[model samples]
Target: MRIERKERADATILHADLDSFYASVEQRDNPALRGLPVIVGGGVVLAASYEAKAFGVRTPMPGREARALCPRAVVVRPRFEAYVEASNAVFDIFRDTSPIVEGISVDEAFLDVGGLARISGSPVEIATRLRARVAAEVGLPITVGIARTKFLAKVASAVGKPDGLLEVVAGTELDFLHPLPVRRLWGVGAITEAKLADAGISTVGDLSRFGEHGLCSLLGGGVGRHLYALSMARDPRRVETGRRRRSIGSQRALGRRPKSDADIEATLVAIVDRLGKRLRTAERVCRTVVLRLRFDDFGRATRSRSFLESTDRTDMIMAVARGLLDDAMPLIRDRGCTLIGLSLTNLDDHDSIQLTLPFEADHGAELDIAMDQLRDRFGRDAVTRAVLVGRHHGDDAPMLPD
Candidate 1:
């Protein structure tokens, strides 16, 4: 039986993702790590090289488990500064390739090269040049996948990983996607995958045969309908340019270092200051402050505290974040922490929301606004929190969308 692809198709969406971003950068800079099982982040495994993955090593896995899997692996601490620099260089190339770009994270993005065929050449040609440029300029391996839809493009990129390229031609999407496992679909987590397996639906072809109504009955309406559409490669989303995200966040990998309370607090302050500036610049206010932590044992925890009113002030958000961190101090001390991240969520349009009534004024907001203006006029580093001063690695690393 033949499968039908979506009509009026064009393989224009390009999903470009870095291959083992952190590990690749480490190998690119250090010759000794090349072609070896190099793992970045000794505690939580932020990234594992393709060589390490061959030995059954995966990221976010326990350091002990990774060590056991790849006994000869070269373990190193993550350099957030280097990673951010490389990411900026790579993204410069992305902008050069296409005008419409959506950054998914520090390492991955979706670029729409639908037009510009005359100037940039075919989709494959554009992707080829993009890969070559990133390799030559950033010294990193990037995988590119070109397809008609964003979902298919992303899946194509994943299938062609560790420095490779794949393009799904129009009218041939099902031929490419059907044979892949159902887990390749976005919404299929371990639990859903287990359920699908129990239902004898292992591949996209099997799921398609089971039909949308049947799948809906099995997995509930919303997720089931979504997965059914994806299983058939029918994504209608476009590459969003300059998309304003609801939340802005940043994270740092601390590796196996022993951190004092003061050290952790300093890191938290730096993160809050950076994110607060981003939130304000986006003209958004957040009601929730989320603190994400990963322990030396590779266990992760997320704690969030909501304010009574939305805020864009760094001091106010930082106070709540600090309190959340304080509450998690026992766990951090017990487990030995490895990573820290902060995200501001539950966003509101700052222009629309009247944040301050005369009775509910924030005294610190004036200082916050002044600092933001100074940083905007001069540079992001123009105003720095005093607590982060003189500390090593406290310089603001470029915050990437994630």
Candidate 2:
């Protein structure tokens, strides 16, 4: 059954994305790094400036390989605080432009400017002003893509990267989208792109011609239908604001170095500690613990466990996380894990948890609250788990606010 989608007549949705966000932040703060190849993070390439990207430097690549690719690149450790501050400033501009804003990450957002045609001018005009404001106010390069649909807007922004603005007018979206490579479509990652390439479907037009049934036969139902819809420029989603995050999590990239079981456990402990603090601070509780591993070969594995009841206690969440990690250890050992991450999912407001018996005391919860208070009062380093005392957990990757 094909459901008809009526897209907006005007291209009002804007996708504003900061170029090479972390690396750009570094470059903006240091005049010497501007226009020069810059890389953020010494162990892993968190971000690379366009100058470095021209030399094939990409995120998650090991520092050694990145240096080999761009020897002149100035590598700097990630300062997440600075990135967060810059993100806040950019988002402030987003809100000032439009009340309907959907933040995709710390560096990108979707905004609906449909109703501001009179007061703010056309979408293109608003985008130009937005770009100017970000440069004048925050001193960062942001690309804005305006389209009738969120998907197309995001794609336009990607095409008009490194400080540019593009608008895909209504009735001409197909003309703009069809000539692009299949990889430009959402959900078409490297593996999917390879699969499509094997079948000689290289462009969006080719995929659209292949039809949904053919794609389903090749790529399974969900992904195939999705790609076909996108190839036809059929996205109907609108910019949504005030959406609370469904999950709170953190991950640490461990470079291509062999780690012992103890080392892995310590990393896990540190991650859980940070997540627990964040969850409690947000007044949320999670019922599921998920462990994500990226192997040295770049293959990924995920193992998750859900509890009957949700809690914000660090010890309880860590216990489940440890169990999931334990179950995945054999696979990690075989694959040579290079990264470890955790997500606390199935979240709800703290008030949703049923009241405990009046006399039933949760010492673990008390401890968690106490520790969070100390961390809040002093600093994140004020309290630490014994397991993470002397271990280097690596930088906490910047993320959207929970």
Candidate 3:
């Protein structure tokens, strides 16, 4: 047997971010939208293409407002499925580039390309290849930034936006960081920006000169110390792929169609079944169940419940979910539901969460594993509950990795 050991290298963190994620996908699939300002989502701007952004259009703004900014922009409904597919393909490229990848969202991640000096040329080489692969395979342009730490790498990527690459050489870290705005530092939101600007600290260089005590006095102890360090170009965090999300959720938009209680329950069942499969696949158990609803009037409501014990079992979780649904049945009846979403939170590792009941002794564990295997071998639509027979909830949306 032969064994090979991996080693770390200097300046190996690379931040890869998809440019204009949702809008990019819209343009990529529809050639007519190419080089044209595109906006995804009708009620609110979910994403704006680089072209639309150039017109001062921003995401999460009111759809009417976005259109007002750029009346020429092509508006399209959000296809979560397509976005998920693109996200998964792009993430696959990320994993292929490095074994250590910390996903920030469906669109961006921090990849550690350290210790690939022998197999891969350098951090710059790895990022270049990764970007090329994503463009070729997924048909999306991605920006990459290379630095010694995750923060700088992410900042570099943001600075080099709209399909660009930037490398912050180790020796020139401060020279590069100091010239930027204070808002570029992590945790410096609108309020922080205002505070810093009020203090005459318009740039990172100004904040860097402001001693930690003054910053602490200006921003309070916790946030003050943190920003001071980032201003000084110091970040010790590394790429961590094992840090799973607090919850895994899926939702369906049924538009203004009126659905009966039975129909709603069936839809919820489909979401629960699929999410249950996802929960178990991630080796996680949840203690809380959250139900989110959007009514025909465009109003939203969320209801949640927590259990004494954490569980990964579908039937067990479904019971709790159904209970939540029943509790909100009156609201649904009055409001006329248009969208349904469910999220399982309060997650704990399956290994760390001891079984309160003899689930395996009851033979439920065997059945769950059996169904999972069948689904894996076949498809997600392979195994379903009795209620789902001859019923359609919605198409399966693309998903982020477990």
Q: Give Cα-based local distance difference scores for all models.
A: 0.86, 0.89, 0.85
* C-alpha TM-score for every candidate: 0.83, 0.94, 0.76
85-157: candidate 2 lDDT, tens digit per residue: 9999999999999888888899999998887888999999999999999999999999999999999999999
Clashing pairs in 2: none
- Per-residue lDDT of 14-99 in model 3, one digit per residue for the tens? 99999999899999999999999998866557789989999999854666778899999888878777888999899988888888
The alpha-carbon deviation from the true structure for residue 272 of candidate 2, after best TM-score superposition, in angstroms, is: 1.0
Model 2 global lDDT (CA atoms, 0 to 1) = 0.89
For 311-387, candidate 1 gives per-residue lDDT tens digits of 78888898899999999999999998888888888888887666445786657878988998898899767878788
Question: What stretches of model 2 exceed 4 Å from their correct place?
Answer: 1-7, 358-360, 398-402
Q: Score candidate 3 by TM-score against the native.
A: 0.76
Q: Cα deviation in Å at residue 213, candidate 2?
A: 2.8
In model 3, which runs have C-alpha deviations exceeding 4 angstroms? 1-9, 251-274, 281-283, 290-305, 313-342, 349-353, 356-402
Best by TM-score: 2
Mark the regions of model 1 whose C-alpha exceeds 4 Å error after superposition.
Answer: 1-8, 252-267, 277-284, 293-301, 326-340, 347-363, 366-402
